[model samples]
Target chain A: MTTTSARAAAADVVIRTAGLIKDYRSARRGRTTGHVRALDGLDLEVRRGEVFGFLGPNGAGKSTTIRILLDQLRPTAGYAEVLGATPAAGGPAVRARIGYLPGELAMQGRETAGDLLEHLVRLRGGRGSGRIGPLAERFGLDLTKPIRSLSKGNKQKVGVIQAFLHAPELLILDEPTSGLDPLLQQEFLAMVREATADGATVFMSSHVLSEVEIIAERVAIVREGRIVDLDDVATLRHHAGQQVALRFADPIRADEFAEIPGVEDVEVTDHTVRCLLRGEPDALLKAAAAHHVVRWVAEDRELEDLFLDFYRVPAGELHAEAEEVVVHGR
Target chain B: MAVDTAARTPTPAPADRNGARADGTRLPVARWVLREQRRSLTLWAISLAAITAMYLAFYPSMATDEMEAVMAGLPEALMSGMGWDRIATGSGYLESTIYGLLAPALLLVFGIAAGARLLAGHEEDGSLELEGTAPVSRRQLLLERFAALTFGLFVLCAALGVATLVLAPALGMEVTSGNILAATLGLWLFVLAMATVSFAVGAATGRRALALGVGAGLAVFAYMADTIGEMMAGGDWLSTISPFGWYLGGDPLTQGVDGAGYALLAGLVVVALLAGLLRFERRDLGV
Candidate 1:
């Protein structure tokens, strides 16, 4: 079922991008002033029936990639294919099979949630109009109440439901759980599960790693508009490697633990043996037992640290980094 | 599975009735766009009707012998500049005041202001994304919004026309009903041409303020050129180029319909719309 196509495994690849580049040109009075490379030679491939988490900090070009995928923004260079077709050429036919939740939802309409949902459903060819009631009920959304009157959480609920209403083949959610309460976040995960169970491919972007870490089987970590790492969620966590520090009762020779398998950077400073350990630490633990270790502190390497290492903004340039995002004009 | 079954809220009122009706039309966005503005459109129509009625009711008192003598004493150039040159006759009085200045001004306001907001307003507030990403193509979406804007203009124009035709005779104003129809049609075409331009600008830029500025800006420039063009070196040329000149210069009230002028206005609408869509298709939205 998966034959490798010219560029990708076309049969199984739900979303694919190759060297996609987007440059934001800041202009004044129709003259280009400067440019920021929002997406720098980004390549991505999302397979069918998988929740692919796009992990990156702010200004890592997460939203830019989502917009390009949705056809809201065009790439300055390269190509993107969603649901077996290039979005630009396919247009509505391609869009019809996809549902997207924008990171920024406009909650300025005067119509009630019910009215807005009904109106949009009709525009989407009225396919999923019947599900609106059940979805609203599940979310505790007062459908009759006007959208402007709703609280932030409730407004986000409206947005969440709308994205799932059509039940398309692919769902691209940008910061889907940003405004939800913990309870609602669970319900949202359930929704994602339901969508996936129905054979939908999910591509969700999040700066917060834990939320995505729970559901995303695989993830791509981006930094400065380029992917620094891409791997299975469990594999990435394993690759992070543990940080271990053992304080011993007796003076210890650093050479004793140096020969232990799966341990490196062994250091002995005043009977405190500290080192970076990978895989099972059983061998190192056995070696440390010989030194009459008084205090053993071994911390499993948190993927959060690794995520931050890959995505953290270099300090002293926060102002400029933020400005690039602002000047990027979304 | 965090499906909180115990907290099941009441389901939304069946399928939305308005939605059902909208789907039947096969032009849901267009129908929905018009339906959502029903209250505002009604208010605009009522206000237009009331204004026309109020203006027409004053014609009898304004056409007395003393008023004619006063009009005669006024300088001809001054009277012409004020759009009140033919104020003595029944048709002339309507032409100079009601047909010439008042109705056209109100229509332009309704057309340009409403037109500019038709697309850009939705776009600026961010709701345009709902339609923009729906199953419909961008081209279909633009055409639907444009159609709704055009139809809304008709409602406003009809309100003014109905008021004039029904109330003019009751007030002893000897205005020809046929000429009234011609003038109303002429006014619709003129205002529509301008509104379409405003619409096209908004569609292309997705900036309501800029779109509105261009719309209002064009109206001001056209009105000035039309109002003062007669005294300028090449006056006849202004009458041909300016929309206001096509509208008030030909004086639809006394002269009846100008077929060529109406055609030009219609043609301008098509041209402006196509130009706007070209940019709309290429540019990024809500930038």
Candidate 2:
């Protein structure tokens, strides 16, 4: 049954999930067992050789989806396929082809970072320590120091190195830069780009919009256990409105600013006019030129707020859009 | 230093080079688990052996007629209840005092602690999540941990046996080498069964408190059953159900090996291990 589906899916679609649902049931104590829906009919796809961003707030099911992809957690309903095979059924065969960095990575014992990475490399069936030496150098990690003695950021560097050392076909990183400094985060981003250049697929989840904006070509914004928006990074940025606060030499009416193109939610107080401007600002600039402008300030709307706007949309409408995308193979 | 992007991104290696054998066999996780356990296993073996030797060293002085008289003066029922009925003979004295009592107690503590650390400890610390991401199945992880536990128990028992054997002749204790080996084997099997129960419970539930509670509770119940069963006639059947009963019932120190008793302990280990493996495979990890 899986073979037929695997053959049907283009090899380019490295990750595909159809109505994947994950519900975690609290232990049954008496008759009242609580069920937390971590993933609610989530349908997602990541094409081959691309860095796809998974953006969501905490408890928004980003980690749950990653766990299902890694076969760490089984979905309650629906189908999930990674690299042309069901993760649970493929087991180690599928896992062998993927490099994963968990959100909360913990290392035990007094083993040095070198020792831990060496063991992981061996477990991945890679030969020699040659790969690790280069990764350690790239991350500026001290392999000689014990893991327990390393700071959280250094430990995170170790996690990043191990994930890339195997050079697997797919990389599933959950909050990959949680403890990393900005400089190291950029280095990690470069590493991701390099991996994708070598024909690897990256599915990275993060709440940091700027980071995603910098590297991700496409992103899926998850909210309340569902993917609220999935679109090209450029298109999403184009939809983001700008905050235009204009202070005029003469008193301006709110309706005058509202008459301008691409302007919405206008507020006028005496000589000050503030409004949201979407799309091109050429028309609004010309309209402001008609009035004597004392001070003009236009700030780009935060991507975080744009994400929240998508979440604010009604679930049924978002679900319909998601379904349309799925049906049309967008 | 300038970062080398070209060097960092090497040509992708073949899929097979990552860890797969020609026959599709992989033992990396198992080997890794064993490596992690090495230091702790060594410390446990050495500590157990040293404690066993210390107990053995006191045997020579306690072997006198005066000690025998004191042992004889105790009530027969009391001596039997405490497992000290044969305190006069060197073999009986060592069996009743050390192997029968102290050894099993210490090993039980070791087994329970090690078993909890292997599964629940790793889960709680979140390391198990990273392991799960590798090309290793949950069943493989559980089995490898169980294997490490088994190996550690074997080493600890072997150390105790060697210590007793070396100290027996020098201390004038007339225990046979066969008896020492049998006693060590019996203790190892018994404690291993208990530890397997702990491992199985922890793997199934992922709750360290529950696992420790059940494992320690069963051991205490079994010990008390054996002790109480010896004092009362009607309760003899109770000892039959306890692991301690199986070990003491075999009388390994004096009677050499008890095939039936060893089989019971082995059977318990197998059943508990299977339960753990099944539960671990089915449940979500790092919860």
Candidate 3:
């Protein structure tokens, strides 16, 4: 199964991992050492020219995966390749073509944003300053202010600008919109779209479901260091469906709505009925219309709730849902 | 967006865009590291120069025969341990008082602090993640940071040497330019060896406390061994293994340069630096 998907995405596989595993050990005096498995047989693939979202909660090894891709950390077992080259073999050459923003952005020294950016450009072998002016303007960042003096949002802007200033072939951003205002977050999303439009690939990791839904075409949901669900945004939205709640003028029988298609977890209490509605809602709507409707409310199920559901269900059950989507979408 | 406009602008060719060179060499990471340490380097140089100037200025008043007689009456063991046995001669006084004990001690503090900041401090603050993600390899980053440390130490020693040279004539001291240069060179090498040890340990462990503890503990032990070893029976050989002994063992000021001692110091530096680079390359960063 892995080989089949690998062949399908062979032409444009920007990032690939095979049975990747990372383990951390802690040793204390007079006690046996303890070990934690950060990543366990994780296999993932990211394609070029696409904005791929890596979604996971804290301690899900999201940062560990990013560090491995950048060659900052070596995996305990298995392999990872970026841009068709293993990170260890082609380390500097591969990193040169990629821009990365860490989950927590911290700048050292007393250098101003301009000084640090210029220095980073030189480290990449670019002459003078490479296109920082326009980026700073877009992010509304002041170039002359010292990085330590900048607020969290402004520091994030510096991180974002540095990653984009070099115009590399790929951008790997971890929690890119963190510490930014709502308006700035929107601007950041626009910048990501602009980068993708210019034929660059973006691999972003975040726990924010709405942000990923806004920008990513596809997402890989990781749990306990392994990717459990990989699907298109539209398909996940279709499977998640909408939550429907209705209060009728007359008391309705609980079995009256039992025959409605695409409804689950139905609960009928006195004059109120609440349930999850998937697929077409026409049948549920028609059932609700049989009696005079005093108040009707149907809200789209949040992607965050769907993500929690993915976490609650067993991997085999989620795989079954994904398989159904793949069969139907094909 | 501005990115669109900048993209549309006629930029250089793809080769230039990637910032690769025909010689396959990119920009040196050392330059960036050096730039970051500029302010601290200046402060260290100035502080070292001030200390040297103060000692040189008081040489004239302390060069009297009465002072020499008083120093001579002191206990032989105590004077030898303090390195004040030769407190009358110009070169001997400078070597025993400053270069032998005080200068290296102060410079070790400087070196250890700088080394800790280079690796462990950055790691603690989470800035290493951003720096490590660049085009530079781990070996390149470690080497460049070590280069910055070496450069800063050189500047501090150079400042001290020039200040001593300028003050010698005014204070009626008969110190040769060669002696001053030799002493400064020995002090620089000693401090550099200590700093390299700190850097290597820090890079390997990625913890500031361990680096400071190990580096400082070694320095303190070496100093104690050199000072108190002379009084202990059969402890004369203790100084042989100490870095302080390797540095001041040759009496660099009066005897000119100790080629073999300098060679040993350089060798220690290389071995430690290689160990650091290897450990850094193999381990995880910002852990």
Candidate 4:
């Protein structure tokens, strides 16, 4: 069920789905059974120009949602709208204005990257040939090789180029950074940001929390075909704190370390120790100074912690415990 | 990193409609089908050319004196295997030879090509998934593919027709332009029927080897059944079920043109085509 509040009304949304569901009937057993409920009453809305990160673990509805938006898969029930028109009615024009990188991109083996790009461009009603070179150059892709000869990562690069070649208004990428190295990942995020700046909206799905945390303006985390959390990353991070590590020059006894206010749990191995701390780090640092402060590292809990938290894995069961610490702002 | 200082840039060129025809001219589904078949098309064309040449090379002796030997002395086992015994010499020896050999070869090639296109080729390369996402509907995809298969059969038939026209004079065989054309068309219909069967098999199994194997097996079975039924029953009634039976009954060598038989073959082709299309449309891709 979708709750249309005042903020959603003001955003001029480009894509929205209400109570979306998809069921797959298995063919093998001759008996009509084992329906995979890939998507279940998913309620999602993406506003214009915002880079919405759709995060979920494997078997969640991330790819399913993107497929529904592209009109590749029919929903068992519920309604989906893209750019103000129903996905069913959107047809080629809707496809023309949207760039999509499918979760699995296995292209025809015989065609060269240039030929494939040319064909896709023509399908999008563009001057297909010349754009292939420019797109390949921008993505650092080689267009001369046959599709079969290229590795999976290179093939993904070709898919990326073809998707971006048409310069569609909305880019829906599923696990876009999987094949990219760290440098390329940064470049790709830059490209996405540039596209967003030009009024194009990017709705990306990924399981990588760190990558999502880097550029996502708002994120929706899906678990078991349901949206578990949807909010700004900074806000989620503030509520979920950072992970901290500290090392003392002298060996600190376990009982002595446990007595500190903010140090929730402490593990001592010989002269080194690790602690999970909540709130500010100044108080913990002061406590550690009584022994000998050799090296100190204090950082907030990562997005993974917040993601795991939403799964209802109790705080006691979590390996790390949270503690409150007092820090004075200089 | 700071936001792009360029503030705003003009919307990138409005999405290109790549290469889909403008104003929706809708090229006959044949073009798209051929586009998918691009890899193996040249090799298929070359093989068809070679088969036509071979058929032409042996037409002389096979049509005349040797024809009498084939009728009187050929082993029953070989005769049954080749579907040769059922063709009466009264229908003319040349028709018997052409009907016995060329018809089966055409049907086999058609089935093989259909199997490759519908099953192994698409599944192996993953274009099957890509096609599932394309704007083209499932029925449209099948129709276009069938159209290409029909066109390929036409080219093969034309090659055989040209070969027959050239071989008739050297062999002193009676071969009218009308008879050769009618027989070629009849042969094409037989191949089309087989292709349609393969199309259905491919859709049902979604496996290349299974579709090709089952289609070829079905054609051979239909031929053998018709031939055996004819030898024992001594009537054309039972042969009506087999495409091979229809083509032979058309008598491309002697009758010049069996319009009624050819018409029946065309009817069967249409029926098979409709059945295949319906099955394909209903079945899911990438299954």
Candidate 5:
């Protein structure tokens, strides 16, 4: 089935964080300093057997949501439920059923990858050999080297393997592909697909919506600690599509094109007219052909334009932040 | 050929056990603790062996006539500090004074250090989160670590007992191997008590240095209280407040496991363990 049908078909809710808010006081000042509102009154849900993409701007509470859901960080207010139990109220029972890759992966320096894998499996109540070796092989992880000696990307590969080794019912990953290259990112997506194929729910948090666009059935866009948009991937795209510019064969007045369906902000400049279109292109084409029989160029709408329109931020300012998002998605 | 077809995947049945997804057994708790303690095992073995070997090497040399005469000529203050006041005078006294008091002190420090490392040190190194999210209760985790430390202490005590048993005959000492075994086991129980106390401190304050500092400071204070209570004569009741005093008064080297002292030490250990569990249950794991 398609993702939309799959979402409608499955009634299971694997994870939900309701009215979650987290506040962190500044470390340097003793007084309740640096009240970092990491998560702010956010509610989220991930249905079973689908990849849910959690997207947000920098410091926009994507990680905060994941952390609180995993019971790694306590919420200043509100509560979270993972796998049908309150996370803050002893979520270990729920945590055991889920696989989590932290946004920041720091492991024991002296331990080799093999040793860490062996130890983590035993800790998570599974046999060490059940999935470690195969997952490592798939990810091209060198399990022989000490963790301290491994590169950042190598360590991230180990983190990925460990999280997926147990084959959890719910996989909660925070920037799980942070250090992976393009090929590995695809492989990781394939792994997620396989897990979802086995009736698992994958909650992938990343700043780049494009990374999510490939695998996510649904995308939740978070901004400044609140979810600004929550919808299926196709709907979000439809709602945020950029305008289509249409040029006429002859000198047409800007006002003439304005009356055409789905055309907005028409400007006629020396036999060329630029306009934004939301719906079908046939109407604009018909309108242009009636004016004259000549050549025209209809510039394709960029996805970035749609992104800016929906986010309400200027394109140039978001470019730097988008680079960081790409870095996070790796 | 044109084809219009689809594959329908069957839906899985709902999980039979509604409240169960992961195993709720406590076995993982023990496994996690044992795996974490692998590094500490080698260090603990070497250190405890060194402390025992240091005593074994030096004790036999003091068994000679000239050395015995020198010990007999030692000042009362030195003897008092060295725990020479309670037991009979002999090479056994020297052995007991060394192993009975100092060895337990060293073991207490070592065992308690290991206990302190279980939480506070793991938290400091950022690996606490690995096990913190495991399907284990905080109390279960704490008890598992204490069990590992207690197991390690038992190994240390057994090794010490065997070493003393083999060496006692060569030294021409008349002490029974049974007495030495009992004394060693008793000393281990006392150190276990100290370890339980340290575990409580570690869980209560999620800071390694602070836990160790507080544990060591508490030991020193107990030693002082025991010393002052003993010297003052009328204030012997004050010794009840310190676990060190309770175990130290047993004089296992010569007296060989007095019932009251054994009871006191056992009570102290049980109380400490229960307090540690309660504290662990109430506190958050990675705080």
Candidate 6:
């Protein structure tokens, strides 16, 4: 289903990083102490107009990576480029085409939201006034209230507005929906959709899968500064296996169900049989029909298990497992 | 304080957002920096006016012979040590106390506080992320912010100049407007030196306490080097390098423009700002 237009669009890499490394040096009493590696040879390629999700737990170098792309933090070693220009060498001209939302936003002033936005718009030297009204109205943001008086959600809305104000070619948002309520999260998602429709690329990072799973075409799960898992949402859905339990009218051979394709971890106690069903369940279901079916129950397997497979393993072992997953995924 | 951003457009932006074609766009970052500081600047200006008026208004009373004898009766070493040499004459009284001592000292505190807060405080509080990622370059951000700091300090120092000119005649201080300008200009430049020092430290370190400590510490050391060091044998050279020495030692009140004072003090301000910019750009921010 890849149209020529889609193929052409997918060829452009909006952001690229290779062998990127960032190490933070700690100090005690002015003495040099050991350092923590925030990023270890991380690589990424985000296609144009794609909603790429950067997933990681806290202290996983998610923020560190975003900051490096924005040239806010220089990498200890390696390279990063945005829109064909090295982020550090891109200068302001390159950044002018980018919009960023910091994860830990700090807006302190007596200025009202309107005042802050106006100042921000002026700072970018853009005609952002056009986007301000609709974005604010859509988010149900009160523009006249002083920024300090606004609630956390309201402050986050302001951050959202400023990020989209200029309609930059690329948007780098770090936990953009942190304080939004569920309903507002929907509105934020819709806004992101419209932004992408207009040919803008979105690179959003989140620790949770709910939002990212909905919008992202591809996602990279980072752990301890390296990408442990990466896959497409479509592939992710296919991997969403379910745990199935069936109670037969009489005792039957549970070993038979275990032998079937796409069924795993079968266990039986007298009349009931339990197993995991991955992909199509037709074969497993048909096999169960031969026996009396008294009751059947199934629950979707937790996605956390997929992440646990990566997160719990030691780094050296995870590398081989991660490569295997990637190889089998495609 | 909003300079038409047009007038201050930074060194022709290498290129506009669209391409290599540069445009004559205004400098909004500089204006934003100034706007952010307006409230603090207002408070500092108000305090400066009140203190300057209160101290200058009492100059007439302190100019009396009785007050002069009282100042003299105090230990000569203590009086001379604090630079309170001539209270009988209006010029001497103004120079030794208000113009020379209190105004510069208070201005130093204001400058250092603002300097520390300018970059380092915002960086620590995590507020610098907004401007840091804005389409503006670090050079523009640094210079524009420093411009705001420079503008804020300059305005307060200029107020001291104007207030003294207005009060000198009413208080019967035997000093011309030109003399007040000369003396206040020295103080103003001296304050700029210290403010830039603090600002440079903050920009380079991204630590408010370090910036504040280093700035305030330098002010104390410079004050000592200029005032107390003179008493020590072979210590006369200390004032030559100290900003306080550049202002007070030259006695700009009596000696019209201290060309050397203006040059050296202004040189220090420029050097600090450029050095800060170079360091700030080279180092990792938000550390």
Each candidate's number of clashing pairs is 0, 3, 0, 22, 1, 0
Report DockQ per prediction, comma-separated: 0.40, 0.51, 0.52, 0.23, 0.20, 0.36
Stretches of candidate 4 exceeding 4 Å from the true structure: A1-11, A27-33, A127-129, A245-297, A305-330, B1-39, B63-70, B73-99, B110-116, B119-125, B200-214, B234-237, B256-284
**Tens digits of lDDT, candidate 5, A161-275:** 8777766778889898889999889888877877787788899988676788789998877777766566777766654434555444556677768888667667777777777
lDDT of 5 at B50: 61
How far is B178's C-alpha from truth in model 2 (Å)?
Answer: 1.4
Kindly report the docking quality category of candidate 3: medium
In terms of lDDT, model 3 sits at 0.82
Best by DockQ: 3
Q: In candidate 1 chain B, what residue range of length 10 has the lowest lDDT sum?
A: B4-13
lDDT tens string, model 3, B1-287? 54544562225537665545333234366666677778878888898889988987777777889988999888888887777777777876787767886789889998988887789878888988777898888888888788888988899889988888888767767878787888789888888988889988999989888888888988898788877776566777887777887788788878878888778888888998899888888888887
lDDT of 6 by residue, B1-287 (tens): 11121221122322344342223136676677677778878888878877888888888777777887788788766676576677667778788778777888899998898888889998998878888898788988888888888888888978777888898888888788887888888888888888889999999989899999988998998898877766665778887777888877877777768888788889999999999888899888898
Model 3: residues >4 Å from true position, as ranges?
A: A1-8, A29-32, A247-249, A253-262, A280-297, A313-330, B1-10, B13-28
Could you give the candidate ranking by DockQ, starting with the highest?
3, 2, 1, 6, 4, 5
TM-score of each: 0.89, 0.91, 0.92, 0.79, 0.76, 0.90
Candidate 4 is scored at a TM of 0.79
TM-score of 3: 0.92
Better of 2 and 3 by DockQ: 3
Assess the local accuracy of residue A300 in candidate 1 as a C-alpha lDDT between 0 and 100: 71
- Predictions in order: lDDT: 0.80, 0.83, 0.82, 0.67, 0.68, 0.82
How is the predicted docking of candidate 4 categorized under the CAPRI scheme? acceptable
**Error at B222, model 6, angstroms:** 0.8
| lDDT at position A303, candidate 2 | 80
Identify the leading candidate in terms of TM-score: 3
Better of 1 and 3 by TM-score: 3
| lDDT tens digits, residue span A1-330, model 2 | 157644654556999998999998866753447888899989898888888999988889999999988887888999999998888888988988888899888886788999888777666655324677877887889999988999999999998888887677899999999999999998898888888888888999998888888889889999878888777787676566788899999888777778886787899999998988877889888988989999989888878777776667677787775554344432
